[model samples]
Target: MGINLQKGQRISLKKEAPKLEQLMCGLGWDVAKKKGGFLSGLFTTDFDLDASVLCLNQDGKIKSNSEIVFFGNLRHYSDAINHMGDNLTGAGDGDDEQILVKLPLIPQNIHKLVFVVNIYNALERSQDFSQVENAFVRLVNLSNNQEIARYTLSGNGYQGKTGMIMAEIARVGDDWEMMAKGEGFQVKSLGDVMKLYS
Candidate 1:
């Protein structure tokens, strides 16, 4: 078990799990179940939530498309981050997707790694965070598979939103820190969120 983080809470990875060289970021979400709506029992909604990592430089901006790792680009140029493919449907249990990070291999210029999730083809699918539930991001120490911390969110607060800025792992001096953002955005896709850093 690990600390159940609250939104905006930040923790020092170095202090929590010393000698943490490798990390696994696991993200999960569930589709909202229809409640007593007409025809609700006849159809089940499918969700394709994408988890991405935006590697920002010291100036808090993205310099190239290579810095963003997602289903399309699984590995970072520096080999510090790797996204574990895409999960088309938010089905089954446990983490729907995972991203592996090698702390020591991170590039010197990269100061922050922002974790984000967006509905795939949100505009076309007419889907939003309002149809999602039990969204969470958690950090695990890969060495022993121990959970370091977790941040969870309920979709009830993100009505009409299409994307979410979940959390961030930031470099602070010689240590790494993790912060739970849990901020929802109206952006349509991951590319729209990338524009924020560009």
Candidate 2:
């Protein structure tokens, strides 16, 4: 059957090992200006970066290491970068670093799933003011992995930098619906994402 979705309907998944269809996935972030001065909002605070992916499954849970790949440019780190072990730091210029995720098989009876961004480590460092904060995620229905919808996060402020961009995804009818929720703590690692639902 085909998928049907409402405006604000919640999604649920209840089976194990559901057939996951990865639609369109990508990453977007705001880069600080190079020549701009102090008042230009250049090197005052952290720079915001967000990465995301899309998936649909019978089960609600995804593997921890599911390969979530993202395509972009190396505006920051140009040296010593490759398919694996790419370090994305607050430096250089434009967009850099292609993130990947290996998701786990989801659980049954779960309607929606979300992935978040964390920036606790960036917050503690004073010298790392160039790193941006409040990045987010979105999921689109791609015929061959193209763009579709935009799931933007909430609870963002001028000073509120570094946190999770909630990827609230739900199974609407036979298809899926997602909402970008920017809440919770600034994660330092992927392992900290486990506390999202808790």
Candidate 3:
């Protein structure tokens, strides 16, 4: 079992799981079913949300596009991080998408891994996090398959926002710390999200 992390709360990975080497960051969400006429279900459209990670250097900056792990770019050059794939509909019970992290494989220069999610073609689809429910990001010890921590995003706070900064795993001394961010932004695509750090 893992603690349910509140926004801005952080936990030490090393303390919780001493021998932790690899981690699975799982993100899940469901579309809020529309309350409408009998034909609402028939007219519903699947929402596509993309999970991404920005590998930041010691100075908390992204130097190259290769440092980013996403659906299009499944794995990082250092092989420290790998995006499982994209989840088109978010129509599952568990994680819609997963990102694997090999802590030991992470380069010394890489100090942080930021996990984010942005709606694909948000503007064109007329969608935002406001229509999302049960959005959460969780970290699990890959070695033992035990959850370490989880952060649940409040849907109401994300109205009019298409992008969300879910959480971050940052190197701290000889260990790693995970922080729940749950910050929302009005961005159109991953390119726009990248600009925030560029």
**Which runs of model 2 end up more than 4 angstroms from their true locations?**
1-20, 33-87, 90-110, 127-136, 140-142, 152-158, 187-189
lDDT of 2 by residue, 1-198 (tens): 222223243333222114444343333444335456666663455443334332324454443333232223322121111122233443443223233322222333344545444443554553221244323343333333333444333332434345554555665666444544545555554444443433
lDDT against the true structure, each candidate: 0.93, 0.39, 0.94
How many residue pairs clash (N, CA or C atoms closer than 3 angstroms) in each of the candidate models, in the order given?
0, 34, 0
lDDT of 3 by residue, 1-198 (tens): 899999999999999999999999999999999999999899778999999999998988898999899999999998889999999999979999999999999999999999999999988989999999999999999989999999998737788999999999999999999999999999989999999988
- Write one digit per residue (lDDT tens) for candidate 1, span 86-173: 9999899999999999999999999999999999988787888888989999999999999999999953678778999999999999
User: How does candidate 2 fare on TM-score?
Assistant: 0.49
How big is the RMSD of model 3?
0.9
Model 3, residue 47: C-alpha shift (Å): 0.6
- The reply for model 1, stretches above 4 Å from the true place, is none
**Cα lDDT, model 1, residue 7:** 88
User: Per-prediction TM-score, please?
Assistant: 0.97, 0.49, 0.97
Judging by TM-score, tell me the better candidate of 1 and 3. 3
Clashing pairs for predicted structure model 1, backbone only: none
Residue pairs clashing in model 3 are: none
